[model samples]
Target chain A: MDCYETRMEPGDRLILCSDGVTQAGLGQKRYKFGWRRSGELEFAQNIIRKSPEISAKDLAYAIAFQALSISPEKCTDDISCLVIYLRHPRVLRILTGPPYHKEHDHDFAMLASGGANDVIICGGTTASIIERELHTKVEIDLNLMKASGDLPPPGMMPGIGLTTEGILTLSKVCTVLEKKQQDKIPLAAKAIINRIMENDCIEFIVGTKVNEAHQDPNLPLELELRRNIIKRLAIILERDYRKKVTVNYY
Target chain B: MKKITLEICCGTTCYMLGTQKLLQIENIMPEEWKNCVAVSAIPCLNNCTSENICGAPFVRINGEIMSHASVESIFNRIRELLPGEGEE
Candidate 1:
């Protein structure tokens, strides 16, 4: 074993992929997602090309799943990705819907805006309500984060905040939590999950208010209530990461 | 010999109220007592709040809750719980 040391500059992404990613498939003849025979480099480059500002969790998934997407008969190997982000203090606040009743919007906004360094809005209507009530504009760069089907990319809310699809993304996040698997998560959920992992303390201000529009019978059971998803995520964060997770359901 | 699992609350409130100083208890412990105790920092016991009987600066010894915890209080409890040991 050789011990090597190198200085990492800012904006550096170190991708340490296992052989399953490098020498994947049958010889050099096999590659997935339209990459050259030099599959490993191009494969990773492809994921990065899709979303250059990709989170560690998502990037790994993109590669691993693509490997799996290859004809299973050809690709057979264990995949593992160890991502290390230089470690920074992150305080993320996730705001879902407004309070169950209309009267509590004021108090909801107050607590919702409480003490988090960063914010992520899970619902479109919730963003509108926050915009109206708090007078903050929700601006999003769709190109920054790719959008999945029926779900738009995460948008920004001017000041240290981002917004995502309500039931659609929340449903995906819940599945990630339930399955206890982080791979192949939806883009928005992957971003939030990675953000959560970046932070030491996280606050969740979930509105107990249920939206009739979101009560679609065709939706997944957990998607019906954002509160349920928030609570469940809180539990996982606390139990798994041992982070200071405070979920104040307003 | 009975062992003690001590969980120190590092919740925001408790951390603000002086949880850092509580680590000193482990340092001042007698060798015999130190060997029997395992101290770990807990994110939040969900007990510290402005409106509850439990607030920050908490310590739990073998699942025993110690609210508004202090080095003196925790040591006193340890002395009481120590097997066959009497207060010095």
Candidate 2:
């Protein structure tokens, strides 16, 4: 075995593979291009180049799958690929609920827009505050909510990472984290959970405002206060997931 | 009555290019065609690369790829698919 070492900078990706991937499609008539075989290396490079944001595990799967797909009839070797993506630690800031006092709406909006790499605004009213203060529009595509099961659709705004309905989405996030049943979570909650898992530091801006609609007895018992839900999320993220969490209530 | 599925790409590359405006397509869609269209935002279509990143803001209409997509262009394609009365 030959060993080599090189300096890797942040945002660099390292891929290690077995001979199966490199030698795939060798001597195959379909892969013949003059004298060269259209091997898995080319296919892996194409997948990586096209989907630069792909996770390391997904990259490995793609490379191995490509190797298997090429000349599956004569596949005799075991294919293996390992990918390591190096990057700086990321911080995710989540803004949920609305400020208790209407006077602090601008303050809440400014904090949200203040240079966070990943920002998630949960709650329609919370999003509206940001939209009003930042002069940006939050567009919620109702069609995406078809499978969300009573949860309002997710919204998108310029310069914000993610926007979604509050309490319900947070409840789903908590459920998915505790039960590990990601398949049953709604799309918006799934997106939020995915973002949370990817980051090292989590900062939550928990607005203290209480929506009277949630207090109705007709609603599900799980529809608790936003502050309580965020507290639960912070606990799970910090204690269970070992992430650095900071929650500031306005 | 089958509705045409329209998936607007909201990936970082596509959003920066102009998909943000396309998210409002529902607002401007013809009232008669509203029932026939289903629109959603997808994270990425994986059609973008360093070489062809300029062709971003892509959308899928009934699983068919449409690059350099705009709300107007999407409406045109939907018209071709549905061809409602009085629509050119």
Candidate 3:
């Protein structure tokens, strides 16, 4: 973040964004959310409309929040901004990231552990991992943790990279569960099937290397294996969702 | 009555990794377990991937960490935690 300057007029609406907004990852190229002030204004309007009843302060916060939420790795630079209600919008100046911790009320830990809806399962290798990591019997804690926001969010994982495959996988899986429950599938069956499927997936998946390796020579076998696993998952997801799954290597 | 709370981080990596589906875990809960569990969304927890290209999109369960997670794993973990749920 560069500087926070503001000039208040009667009904001037202002908007600001961090360097991250301009540095979004588009393959090797970096791009801004919007190029021009008009476009930025429209982006602001979209942000305002994203959530109803949000005040201007919260709206600005959400814009920043959502931008960062795009990808942790993608946001190399810090983001700082100051929007003023002036006759016309102005950049003032753009800053990179925050200097120090201000009010991140939406702490990552709180969201990961105590979010609105969550599921915790215990079985097979996954159960073993949970037991090993948390040092508790998977059987006892799975349900307890699922029912309670006693855990962290998915991003806390150690390795896995954020990829299109991962995103689609999440969407597809959520769709399956939502539909299954709506159709009154037996909880036991759902759990059993889910456990069987999830146990095969490696935790802390590192997709960036795999993504890069696909194009570059000397790809590691481990990276290839991860890609294959994700591909299989995508196929299963496609079957589950009855849609064509697209996997982006990059 | 056992009280439980689950927070799903909708962070970029988490969202991409299918943590979004964790948001729907509530629907699958048997009526009996509903009252005991609470779910919500969170921002960031500073849990980074070993390699930005490789790691990310993790989750924590009951103060326990589950990194590089997936929807299937998350679902499985939740089923084990819910009351009267899990493999027989």
Candidate 4:
């Protein structure tokens, strides 16, 4: 195999494909008399030129779909196209539950204010602590709350990405992530899941505080401990979605 | 009776001005009018031009644009449009 090296800047795209794509439409009537075998390279280049903002995944799909469409009636070799776009990794920090010790609240808030590109505060008490320590008001969207159905609406803080109710929202997120049911997820959970999908790295700051309300027999079975839910979420994100996940406890 | 759809603009300009206060319309609305009005928040309505920016907070009552919208103004407009009222 010949080796070549090139520097890839942000927003640059690199495409690799199997020979099947290049050899596609070879025996078709349009190319029967021509020396050129296929139009795959020109087709992909045209698609790339047409859509400057097209994602790597979409570009690959577009190329592969074109190859398939060129020879729809015949059984051909496996056609695969992989496109890699170079960009900075996006980091999402999720702050959930309150710390076991009250003294750690300030430290937690300080950590939240650190350099993560996106920050989602998950619990009501957790948000209050951040608001008190960061001196930023958390405005709960009443309109979103009403539209959220059973779940509480998300909130907006000055610098934070999203603020939501803790346990219930996380539980719904876990359910949505596990079941892959996008249509049935609540509004707040949908927002969280959307952010999770957009970012490449996920950092979870879980507080060890145990809420006694969750232990009540009257509570639903899915209302597990905060840490347990976070663990499940991290597992699903890492194992299934192949995301980089880190869990830190305060 | 057809319920009146009230969409409040929660875009950046409107939110900064006062959409948060107007969002509480559902909680503070009179019980009698609750059945007739349906309030929801939507993204920018593209009404924040140089001419309309001063009226940052805007709302739409049954697709009619209302600039400089407030709880009281919305109520008065809804009162005017309610069935058996002006209906226009």
TM-score of each: 0.45, 0.64, 0.28, 0.58
Q: Across residues A35-143, which tens digit of lDDT does each residue of candidate 1 receive?
A: 3336756777776778765667777777677665663565566666655444345678887766778888877766547577677877656676777788876654423
Find the number of clashing residue pairs for candidate 4: 0
DockQ of each: 0.01, 0.03, 0.05, 0.05
Q: RMSD, each candidate, Å?
A: 20.6, 13.9, 20.6, 11.9
Report the C-alpha displacement of residue B10, candidate 3, in angstroms. Answer: 1.9
In model 1, what is chain B's TM-score? 0.85
Tens-digit lDDT track for model 3 on A1-250?
A: 6887766765555666766554433243333342334444566777656753344556577556655655446566665555554332111110011112234312312221222222232112222222234434311122333432312222122221111112223333344543554443333333323433433222222222322312222222222234454455456645663433343331
Instruction: Give the true-contact fraction for every prediction, in order.
Output: 0.00, 0.03, 0.00, 0.03
The model with the greater TM-score, 1 or 2, is 2
DockQ, computed on Cα atoms, for candidate 2: 0.03
- Pick out the ten consecutive residues of candidate 2 chain A with the lowest summed lDDT: A32-41
Interface DockQ of candidate 4? 0.05
Q: Looking at model 4 chain A, report the run of 10 residues with the lowest lDDT sum.
A: A213-222
- lDDT agreement of model 1 with the native: 0.64
Which ranking of candidates, highest lDDT first? 4, 2, 1, 3
Which model scores highest in lDDT?
A: 4
Q: Is candidate 1 or candidate 3 better by DockQ?
A: 3
Across B28-49, the per-residue lDDT of candidate 4 in tens digits comes to 8889989889887653455655
